[model samples]
Target: MSTQTDSKRRGQAFAGAFAGVAIVVVLAVVFFVVRNSDDSDKTSAAAPPPVATQPSAAPAQPTDAAPQPSEAAPQPTAAQVNTPPALSKEPDVKGGTGRLTKLVKTTLVPGTGPAVQKGQTVTANYKLVKYATGEVMDSSWSRGEPFSTQIGVGAVIKGWDEGIVGLKVGSRTQLDVPEALAYPGQGDLRFVVDVLAAK
Candidate 1:
């Protein structure tokens, strides 16, 4: 009976020792897992955020050449053409026999510039008068502005196209337009023109 009781006591001690070892193994596993989790969180917290870098400014290059003077563009000068004589008032037409049958051009003031070309635009001031009555028909001077038109293009009277061509800029001239070259069915007319510009 003593042997059997001793054997039973030994068996009970062995079972309690086995339970303690199992508990120790479980606690060790839990402690290792908690420690690993804490270590991962600390590592994540200690890590620094990515930093952005700014670009550096480049150094300026030096030039060896001396400073030069800046030049301005040249401006066009007015042509050195002849200036016309000043007129005090409009001219009077005289009734004379043997009136001009063709266009008659008389330059009152000569020009020093190039002669007017065909199809070139011309700007001028003019006075138109009836040949027989000396009545002023139209005058640009009274309107205070010059007129611009392409000469020798039938834009004006035939007499003006035929007579005004070959005249230079700044020329002052008198034109006697015959009946055929003047307005339709109109009598002979006179025009005093001051050529201002041509282009």
Candidate 2:
């Protein structure tokens, strides 16, 4: 009876030890599975969202469309180029034989403004024509700019100094300048001057 009891006791001890080892292995496997699942959740939560790309613009294609019309530049009128105001006739200095010894002034249109005095600045529009040829030499109207000068102070030719004095603003006058008072060796010249302003 004692031998049987000893054998039974050894068998029971061995069974308890085997059961403890099985429980330890199951706990280790459960720990590893839980740890791996937590790592997967963290990795998925930390990932960045995917970006969307924009499409590029297409190039323009050539077409057979007609162009739009633009405004045209203005052409000069014949009156503005060749003719003066209707009040005065063109000068006839070409037929004269003798040298121009005197300065001649003809008021085409009389002005209502104050008289032009010596040392006063004047603004005028003038057309200069050669006396012999009647060719248009220079014109302030043609250039679209008025001429400005101080009068009676030798700032201009002696003809202008003597002729333009005592003229009033808004008057149109003709000056037949002699060679002595005109440009050097330019001969007699005709000027149709319209006095616009004087100070």
Candidate 3:
């Protein structure tokens, strides 16, 4: 009876020890599973959210239409030329004549245009000569361009202002200006003037 009792006690002790080891292994497995689950939750909570993306724009297509003209560079045009008026004959002014005491006006050609007014601008071709010596002084015809002046105004000599007034366009007149009306120091003069335009 003593031997049997001792063997039963030894078997009970072995089973108790085995049960304790199994309980410890189960507790260790549970601890590792809970720790691994908490670490994954913390990692997910600290991570940043994904950002949304914008769509790209479409590329432009080529066109078949022609390009427009630029205003900065313009196309060229034809050139223009100017021509002088026609005259039948140039007048021959005689020189070496006696000095004129007063202003003398002689109409060589009659004009068909209107008479010049006091403030009108006059365009004319002229031939100037000295009264005492009959020397040719100036000729607008030789210059190829006519002369222009405001008549009956103080813009020119007193002789031209007084002589050119009331003269009509297309009329050619001879004027003999005395010393006082022509130039202050220059001698008495003569002018053969062709009236071209007055406005």
Candidate 4:
């Protein structure tokens, strides 16, 4: 009887100890879970808001940023400045007097006037135009006012060699020169020259 009683007491004590250990383990696990959940909430609340936004404003709008000028901004091209005037040449079919010498009275183009003595100066502006087409070939008018030439010393075309000696200053004349009198095979060309200054 005593042996049976002793065995029963020992078994009860072991069962009680096992139950207490399980309860303690459950409490510890619950405490850790609660602490971790509270910590996560506190960290999230304490974090600073994004710097991409400022106070008073919700966020920085992309369109609010300063605008940048594009390389594609409209720019003028060389073609624009060089665009030549569109002038058409109409055909004149009627019976005409043809190359009328009557219209070409005086000789010398505007800017190719007379001769300047050695150490002398003369200024002028000129444009070369075809006699038949009346089309201006080239001109130095756009470059500046005019250019100067000193004559009697032969610094110009042969026609001016004899023609410009006595031309008055500030006079404009048209020199209807034959090819032989001018550039050979260059043919009778017309020029209207201005004598801007003479010294």
Best by TM-score: 3
Candidate 4 C-alpha error for residue 135, in Å = 2.5
Question: By descending TM-score, how would the candidates be arranged?
Answer: 3, 1, 2, 4
User: Which 10-residue window of candidate 3 scores lowest in summed lDDT?
Assistant: 55-64
lDDT of 4: 0.44
Q: In candidate 3, what are the lDDT values of residues 33-66, reduced to their tens digit?
A: 9999999999989888653121011001112111
Give every collision pair in model 1. 82-112
Candidate 4 all-Cα RMSD = 29.1
lDDT of each: 0.63, 0.63, 0.65, 0.44
Mark the regions of model 4 whose C-alpha exceeds 4 Å error after superposition.
1-119
Residue-level lDDT of model 1, residues 95-199, one tens digit each, is 323566988888887776678898876666677766776666666666555556666765555677788899988777888878677654456777787776677
Backbone clash total for model 4 is 14
Position 72, candidate 4: lDDT: 28
Candidate 1 — which residues are off by over 4 angstroms?
1-98
In candidate 3, how many Å is residue 22 off?
99
**Pairs of residues at least 3 apart in sequence or in different chains that clash in candidate 2:** none
Alpha-carbon lDDT of model 1? 0.63
Residue-by-residue lDDT tens digits, candidate 2, 1-199: 9999999999999999999999999999999999999999999889875531210110011121101111221223334332335423433323234466799898978877788999877767677766666666666565554556677765566777788899877788888778676665566777777776677
Which pairs in model 3 have colliding backbones?
96-134
lDDT of 2: 0.63
